[model samples]
Target: MKLTIQRHQKGKSYEETFDVASLKVTTLLAALYEIKAKMDESLTFDAGCRSGVCGACALRVNGRETLACSYTPHDGDRIEPLNYHPVQRDLKVDKEKPQETLKRVLPTTIQNPKSKIQNPPLSSEDEAKFRVQTDCILCDSCYSACPVLAVNPDFLGPFALTRAWRYHTDPRYIEEVPNDSIQHLTSKIQNPVLLDTVQQNGIWDCTLCGECTAVCPQQIDPKSDIMQLRGESLKAGYSDPTLSTPSFGTPDFGGGFGFDPNAGF
Candidate 1:
């Protein structure tokens, strides 16, 4: 096996590789441990709750973001820290910023929590709307999977807004959602730094293609989350921020590689 990473050893980055033969490392974490214990002790990566509970071991495998705890290693696989965030050392990313975003979204309950509805009475119609949204683990996989984060670093990405959906969809929320909750959730949608983010760019950039959902180990559907934001924003009649973007500005026109349902060029 040969693994390469954007190594930030001491204070710099260089693509570093390691070779292994006669080997059988399962998870990416195990492979890194094997390399450290036997090959290069200085090599670094991050992992905890190897059962996939904690998202500490996130990395990019074959160019897609994934948690190393759940991802098995492949020979000649190019493994590095997440494509978006700075590599703390090897595969470990600084989750603090994303963590702060989670806190800001306030995606949970505290006082006077709504009683759990036994056989909750959501019409099958609403159930269909809410069911796919309750399964988020806050793994930030969508955050990493997003090309918005790759370039427009300040973009809120998918996790925060998706997380907002987790609570908003709760039938037991007890009271109306607070207006203060999202006063600024999309205010930064137009920040120049994040201008290139998806149509959910503020809440419209998401194609809802389920790429984030497909890669998530925890079954969190980031596409669903972004869609909820779009519906809510439109219901409130807020002008969609991306609509102001030049008709030609959409990546689909050219220059940027927006998702292509039709391709083969």
Candidate 2:
């Protein structure tokens, strides 16, 4: 099959079409591998956990970021590297910094004071609720789907923020520990929007566009999580700089984003 890859090298961006299906399974990475092994030995890309567990293989498929190893090849799919990260070669980009940003944001779990479930027990219902979030393999599809990270470098990507929410939302993490070091850290340093910090570095910036939700193979809805995060922020008295009248349905944090409380979707 014929493949067109968006290539970047030496500060230039261009596309290179190659005939690789003369060889492999047409898996996106396999096709690229064929081209690299048979045609251009110098071609470069990064991949690991070919099953999609590792986000290392992330790339842009027709202008959207997706993990190359996990993406099945389509006849005319245009393959490019991920945006918002430095391209290291033909289909590889550096994702560490963004992932690190999430770490800086205190991405972890915290138990709610009212949670009935205990950490060790891990009730079936609560487990089901968080199962999808736990399935995230760091494929970075959510990061690719995030609109805020597209324009605002300061806006931490979904994986990081979502992880933080997982910790805070997990009844286990928050149990009996009214607050801990992480809470303090989320309150002070990393201070992500979803991590219950006072500043605007977290959820307030999320557009909740559902792109992250759509691209997630594991079915985690970072968009919904982000919206829930907004509610958490509001209850915490986090003010929306963009909101004026403070009225209901006012979209107080209208940084170009969504939903009245009852309309949570």
Which pairs in model 1 have colliding backbones?
198-201, 198-205, 199-204, 199-205, 200-203, 200-204, 200-205, 200-206, 201-205
TM-score of each: 0.71, 0.76
Q: What would the per-residue lDDT of candidate 2 be over residues 1-265, giving only the tens digit for each residue?
A: 7788887778778888887656766478877777888888877898888877766787778877677777788778788777677778777777787777656645345544455655567779867766777777876767766788767887777887777667556656532223664454344322233344414556767766778787777778887777766766655555666664345454545534443556566
Q: Candidate 2 vs. truth: CA RMSD?
A: 7.9
Model 1 per-residue lDDT tens digits across residues 159-245 = 776756655555444232345534345432212112212234345655565777777877767776777666665544455665554
Residue 264 C-alpha lDDT in model 1: 52
Off by over 4 Å in 2: 107-119, 175-194, 245-265
Q: In candidate 1, what residue range of length 10 has the lowest lDDT sum? A: 189-198
Error of 2 at 178 (Å): 12
Give model 2's TM-score versus the native structure.
0.76
